[model samples]
Target: MKKHIVNLWAFIHLVAHRFATDGVAQTAASLTYTTLLAIVPLITISLTIFSAFPAFQTVSTNLKIFLLENMLPESAGKVISVYMFQFSENAGKLTAIGTVILAITAFLLMQTIEHALNGIWHVRRARPWTQRLLIYWAVLTLGPVLIGGSLYVTSYFTSLTLGLGHEVHGATLYGLKFTPILLTVTAMSLLYLMVPNRYVMARHAWLGGLVAGVCFELMKTLFSNYVSHLPSYTMVYGAFAILPLFLLWIYLSWMVLLLGAVITAMLPQYAQGAMAGEQRVGYQFDLAVRTLVQLSHAHLRGEVLSLVQLVKLTHIHGEMLEQVLISLQDGHWVLRTNQGWALARHPDKILLRELFERLVFDAHHAQLDLGVIVRQPDLNLSDWVRSSAQLKLGEPCR
Candidate 1:
């Protein structure tokens, strides 16, 4: 239990570091701007899909109302919903070319979200354009249907239970209190699972989603209270106060979502407390050696490694591992393949001296005598990088 607690704390620290360094806030701000630009078009697309099916028309309206009320400050929700409805309604009258433009605008939002999530997952490749087109359109078309259907089913049952009059009112009240949280958790878990290019374990997604969802609820409550109690904003912007508050909520929403992605990506290492020591005493040399050792083994097995594979095996932070890979590439010892990364030269041909010089030797180490170190007979200055289990980068076949 004590170890688990320590691991949990370490994980939290690492998650915070990754979130801050990954420019999550900047991504959120950028997404906020894109969302503001794309909101009307996105709403228009959903409304258009609903228009095709008369039964879903009311589902569309209900979904919008539920989202605005549960996800935004009450004052901001009312004003912004009114404005969005008006804009979406106007969007319905666009010409054919205008409709294509609206769809592209929505695509831009999807692209931004995928890019941000992929960064969290350390994914270096994106889905092919054909695959992206299919996935993006499916999301644009079917996502609302799923959310609306779930909401409809729950509300239907609640309203049905109300046939007993006030007898079930308390149960219904409790249901109302919990529904938003459940929905938030489900939505977040799905986002974490599906947005990243790599595969995500269900448990990690659930854990991440649970934390982010709870935080979202807590933050929403506090933000709403602040906006309500503090009249300063209203006194200043007056009717326009809704704009800034709405934008602020959007930014906060993106942050929570992105933080969840970061947690999900790093959860495996966190599970073992592998990331507890964020910094190492000799990170550069140690990382370089470990990387070379791993690549050497994989080469003998006729396998190459993807970035995700390297992160999994090394238990090193993705960004740091990437930097080490870049250094090795510069030394012409590693190659990036279409399949992944591989050893550019046989491990037996590489020298430990090269690694030491590149990683350990520094301008600050001018006091160390190069000739004296080279003159040591037993040191075997030309030792193979993976020469032996002792040296570990390699040795001769014999």
Candidate 2:
């Protein structure tokens, strides 16, 4: 029980740190504006695609209703949905160049989402432009079809259940209550799983998605409760009141979404004893030791360990693992292949002292260890570390 609490607290601390460092709120605000700008173009594209498929026309209609009802504040949702439909219709009739421009705006929104997710995951490299374009384009084109299809399927079955006009009311009620939340969870999970150009455990992504979906549903309920009191906003801003209210809702939605992303990104890094080094010196060194030990074992088996595998073995997050890899890479102690990361040289060739010497810790950089002065006042940290181990970290890679 105590162990769980400590891990939970540590996880919370790391999340707060990542939230501040990653500028999650700022990123969400940025997304809100980008979303505002690109929403019409996105709608235009989705609507155009649906038009091309006669079978999906009804499903597409249902999709719009779902979005307005679930994602927006009730009073403002009605106004926004009406204006959005009009904007989408106008956008659909544009010339070829205008259509291309609309597509570009929609792509811009995709780019923004990718950037935010990649940052959360600490992914230094992005997928190639061709690959990214194809993937994002696929998502934009197929996403509505998938989502709308699910909604259609659910409603169709529910209608069948209701058509019986029998006593299956409880099951139908539960279904109606849970379907939107389930859909939200599924969609958010896909975003968390795919947006970042890195490996993510499915379980972690699902947990994050679950949280975001439930919170989003609750947010919608909260919005409805206070929507009746929007008379003041109406009195102050008149007809334009919907605009700010809409933006605020978008901002809050992003906040919830990004918090879920943070949770997903942070889970791999959180372990029962992972954060113990935070209060101790050489946290980086400890991470390095754990990583190198794993890589060394993999080397013995003539295997390359992927980032996902390393995280499991060492109980470290990819973000921290990347740092340790870089340090080892700098010293020619580790190698990264197209497949995964491995040891570049013999493990014993790596000296513990040299590894410690080369690595730096941020929080402990200024704190000198003077505990030795009480006994051997002449014994310095450098010599103590130097003579402690004979492992050849200082040796050249084979």
Instruction: Write down the lDDT of every candidate, Cα atoms only.
Output: 0.81, 0.82
TM-score for all models, in order of appearance:
0.78, 0.82
Task: Residues 65-111, candidate 2: write the lDDT tens digits.
Answer: 88888767788898899999899999878999999998999999999
lDDT of 2: 0.82
lDDT of 1: 0.81
Checking candidate 1 for backbone clashes, the offending pairs are: 385-393, 385-394, 386-393, 386-394, 387-394, 387-395
Q: 1-100, model 1: which lDDT tens digit per residue? A: 9977877787788889999888999999999999999999988988888778766767777778787878777878888888898999998998999999
Error of 1 at 73 (Å): 1.4
Off by over 4 Å in 1: 1-19, 51-57, 118-135, 164-176, 197-201, 265-269, 272-278, 281-303, 310-317, 351-366, 370-398
Clashes of 2: 8
**Superposition error at 183 for model 2 (Å):** 1.0
Pick by TM-score: which candidate is best? 2
Among all windows of ten consecutive residues in candidate 2, which has the lowest summed lDDT? 361-370
